[model samples]
Target: MKKLITALSVFAFLGFAGAAHAAEASGRIAMADPGTSTLTLEDGTTFEVVEGVPLDGLAPGTEVTVSYEEQDGKNVATSIAPAQ
Candidate 1:
């Protein structure tokens, strides 16, 4: 039963971990550097768009909402899109 308990604990931890990263709209992007795919938020925050992100129509000076996270103590943009 020890192994079962450990497996249950691991599964529960993983489930809660995903719930912790619940997509949230932190703020809006005000400036974008499509060359490097870096974005500047309205709150004066800058983000490094991860490689392979599809930023087709996203351009500089476009207002957008971002779902981000703090991973390894650094800002990580999970997803971003135009603000409603």
Candidate 2:
């Protein structure tokens, strides 16, 4: 019963952890440094580009929407697309 309770606790924690990062942002790119895989938005938000998200189209003044999560106290983008 103790093992079962521990397993349930872990699962519950995982479920709620995902909800904490369910957020998105839309703004123009203020700075994009491919060397560091980092971007700064016009609103003064800084984010690190996650693997598999293309950066070729990102440039200063480009409008974009970003799906991101706060991991290790840093904003890491999961997806990026042109703002419609």
Candidate 3:
């Protein structure tokens, strides 16, 4: 039981370490809109503005920071918001 627990802990630690590195290597963008935001990343992009979340007050040329992640063999969004 003790050995198994130790192995699992190590695995978790390594996974977290890898994630930290991945985030650092990723690119970041910024947005000017406070109500709505959109960011373009590597192979994928994130957009918060839509029919539901309209960019009514958002100014043009607003940049959004986003990160990319692979999911089901497709690049997907990690996070997106006004580049702060």
Candidate 4:
């Protein structure tokens, strides 16, 4: 029973740690470099987009909401969409 409790505690902590790495931001794009799969916001936050994430119609001055996770000290975008 003690081992089971310890395992559950570890799993819970791991889940929260993973959740903390995910985040969202909304801002106007300062630049969109499809060649590099990178997007920079006017506020200077940069995100590296993962493959299969569309960058269509994204350009300077376009407002967007980005969902990303911090991976290897870089913001890796999981999704990108126009701001409502």
Model 1 lDDT at residue 18: 83
Which residue runs does candidate 4 get wrong by more than 4 Å? 1-20
Regions of model 2 farther than 4 Å from truth: 1-16
Clashing pairs in 3: 29-65, 30-63, 30-64, 30-83, 31-63, 31-83
Question: Can you tell me which runs of candidate 3 are displaced by over 4 Å?
Answer: 1-60
CA error at residue 52 for candidate 1, angstroms: 2.5
What TM-score goes with each of the models? 0.56, 0.76, 0.30, 0.79
lDDT tens string, model 3, 2-84?
99999999999998767632131234333334344443444344443323443344444555443445444434444445665
lDDT by residue (1-84, candidate 4, tens digit) is 999999999999998787746799999999988889999999999999999998777989999999999887889999998899
Collision pairs in model 2: none
* Local accuracy by lDDT, each model: 0.70, 0.88, 0.46, 0.92
| Candidate 2 structure quality by residue, lDDT tens digits, 1-84 | 999999999999999877656479999999988778888899999999987777776779999999998888889998888999
Report the Cα lDDT for candidate 2.
0.88
Q: Order the candidates by TM-score, highest first — what do you get? A: 4, 2, 1, 3
Per-residue C-alpha lDDT of model 1 across residues 1-84, encoded as one tens digit per residue = 999999999999999788536345545556667687777777888776777666667766676777777666656676787778
Q: Provide the lDDT at 14 for model 4.
A: 94
**Ten consecutive residues with minimal summed lDDT in candidate 3?**
21-30
Candidate No. with top TM-score? 4
